[model samples]
Target: MTESILVVEDEVRIARLLQIELECEGYRVSIAGSGHQGLELYQEQQPDLLLLDVMLPGFSGIELLRRIRAGDADTPVLLLTAKSSVEDKVSGLDLGANDYITKPFQIEELLARVRAALRLASGRKKVETDSWLRADDLELNEATREVMRAGRTIELTPREFDLLVFLLKNKRQVLNREQIMTAVWGYDYYGDTNVVDVYIRYVRKKLTQDNQEELIHTVRGIGYVLKDSL
Candidate 1:
């Protein structure tokens, strides 16, 4: 079946361009000019993925993301904005956005990101068939995309979950930032490597919320490692 994508961008030109490009890439695409329309289309179409632009007239992209995450946490959301600050990226990621792309972005890069998000989403569905990755007391169920530490559920964003899963799959091995980024974010990712650190911090913060012993360790001047013991 062809995957459906919902694009919520206020700019008419950008929206049409994206819709045309995505459709040309064999995806079923829907465009919304406002956040209100986006939300309605979201509820009605339930697209496989969402490409959302910030700075909408009625409601901002961040607000729409928050609302979407409140009810649907599994669908991948990619945020498009001109705000390239670390703060904005962190805020969007923290609010459960699957990926972020700065405006004036190359069409090739945008298409790559959209493909990566959809690929990840597809893998998530396939993994729901009893696949589990474990490290120490932390357990990640690929099938359900659930994480648990010491038998307690731990919430994680899609990126965070992917990062943790990558670590677990390569447990006890030091993974450099480049490797982690390429593995988790896709090979065509053009973002800075600091994104790896940011996501690692997010996963660590959530996993250690109950004062649990850290399973992920910084290798210092090298990379990071996840092991049963330091």
Candidate 2:
């Protein structure tokens, strides 16, 4: 089936250009000239991908992205913004936009980003996940974010759960602090790397509540790795 793309831009010329180009590429295109309409159509249509402009008549693109993520976590959204500030890009990525392109972008670049976002959404792996993570008698259901060691339930914050998943997903591979920060916290961050260490400590403390075998292994001079064998 042909991919569907929703173009949400207040500028008539830009919207039409995008629609025409995307259609030429054999995609089904939908246009929404205002943010409100775009969001309304999104909830109803649930297109494969969105080419969303930052400035809109009623609602801004940032607001639309937040609303979309709040409702649906899997939909891939590529933001089109006029601002080139690092802050703007970081905010968009942090809010769950799959990617961003500044205004006055090349048609080829725009098309490439569109294709990449669509591919990511389509090719995402749906893990046959159980209710929780289990290592021996310890368990943590991913669905409920409940952690239990030796039949005793352990509560964890959202960030701690995210950290645990990241480590688990990359089991046996040493991931640097920068990589953890980028993957878990989103990009455009230049702050201290201590945050990654802090979250790792939090997860470790929770996992070791019952003095269970440690699944997270520290590399001393390198980084963190998650594995049962190590």
Candidate 3:
């Protein structure tokens, strides 16, 4: 099946260029001129991947990403912006963006990143066919991408889900930031290792909600470990 891609860019020329390039690569592509239109098309099309620009009319791309993640965290979102500061990158990634590319980027690099995101999504779907991972009272059904803790459902973003699974698979073993990043986000990821700490916090927050016991323990000066009894 040809993967569908949605380009949510406020710039007309850039949007058209992206659409043409993606279509030439055998992907079904759609373009939106503003954040509102992007959101509407996103719901209607349910594209396999989203190419979102940060600056936009009405709501910003970051805001759109937040809203998308609130309800659907499985889709891959790649952010495009002129802001190349470390803070900007961290902000987007923290909001559940799968990847970030600044303006004045090479088309080759953009295509490569897009391919990487889609490939990761494909790999995840393949792994989700018939597998279950568990740690303590937390159970994750990869097939359904559903997580349950103490008989209650727990929602998580794709990255968070991947991180938890990695930790669960290595239960009782301390995994450093580099190890976790490679296993969960792939070796090609070129972001700050602190992203690992951020995601760990996210997982811990969701898992320990409502005064539940914590299964993830931070190892001082090392990394983290998941154990039934910490």
Candidate 4:
């Protein structure tokens, strides 16, 4: 069966264009004009992939992605943003978007990104795993993207989870800010320190709460390191 793709875009022209292009590529395509409608279709159709616009009328794409990831992690979401800022890209990727594309992008690049995301989601692409990493109560299952703390499930945004997993994998190894950015955000990052800072703050706030000893330690003027003793 052909993989089904759902395009959630508020702009009529973009939606129509994507429908035509994707259908021509011989894949099933569906379109929703708003987050509400997109989510409704998602529950009903359960499309194999989602093409979500960052800006929406009723609900923001980031909010929608959060909701979707809360329920399902297997579904691949490609976030399309008009803003090309590094912060925006980092935010989208942090929120669980498999791929991020700024608007006015080349059609070929968009399609390639889509295919790569799908391939990764579908297990067609190989991903290196770090076996397992443990830091105090937090345990990271790198291969499965599962995180647990003291036997309690710790819900994390995709980027937050990735950041934590990466840190844990290289536990005790001080990873500089640039290294973290390059590893988590890929080489596309254009020297955005705020992206790293913002995400690290988010990770620290969300993952370590209720007086839990923080596992992610920040070395002054350096970067971050994950240590169980911290």
lDDT for model 4, on a 0 to 1 scale?
Answer: 0.84
Question: Which residue pairs show collisions in model 3?
Answer: none
The Cα error of candidate 1 at residue 43, in Å, is 0.5
- Which ten-residue region of model 1 has the weakest summed lDDT? 81-90
By TM-score, the better pick of 2 and 3 is: 3
The TM-score measured for candidate 3 stands at 0.59
| TM-score quality measure for candidate 2 | 0.56
Q: Please give each candidate's TM-score.
A: 0.57, 0.56, 0.59, 0.54
| Alpha-carbon lDDT, every model | 0.90, 0.82, 0.91, 0.84
Candidate 3 lDDT over 129-186, as tens digits, reads 5577888789998778899998999999998988988898899999888999999989
Where's the lowest-lDDT run of ten residues in candidate 2?
125-134
True-structure lDDT of candidate 1: 0.90
Ranking by TM-score: 3, 1, 2, 4
Model 1 misplaced stretches (Cα beyond 4 Å): 83-85, 130-142, 145-230
After superposition, the stretches of candidate 2 with alpha carbons farther than 4 Å from their true spots are 83-85, 125-230
2-58, model 2: which lDDT tens digit per residue? 988889998999999999999999999999988899998998888999988888889
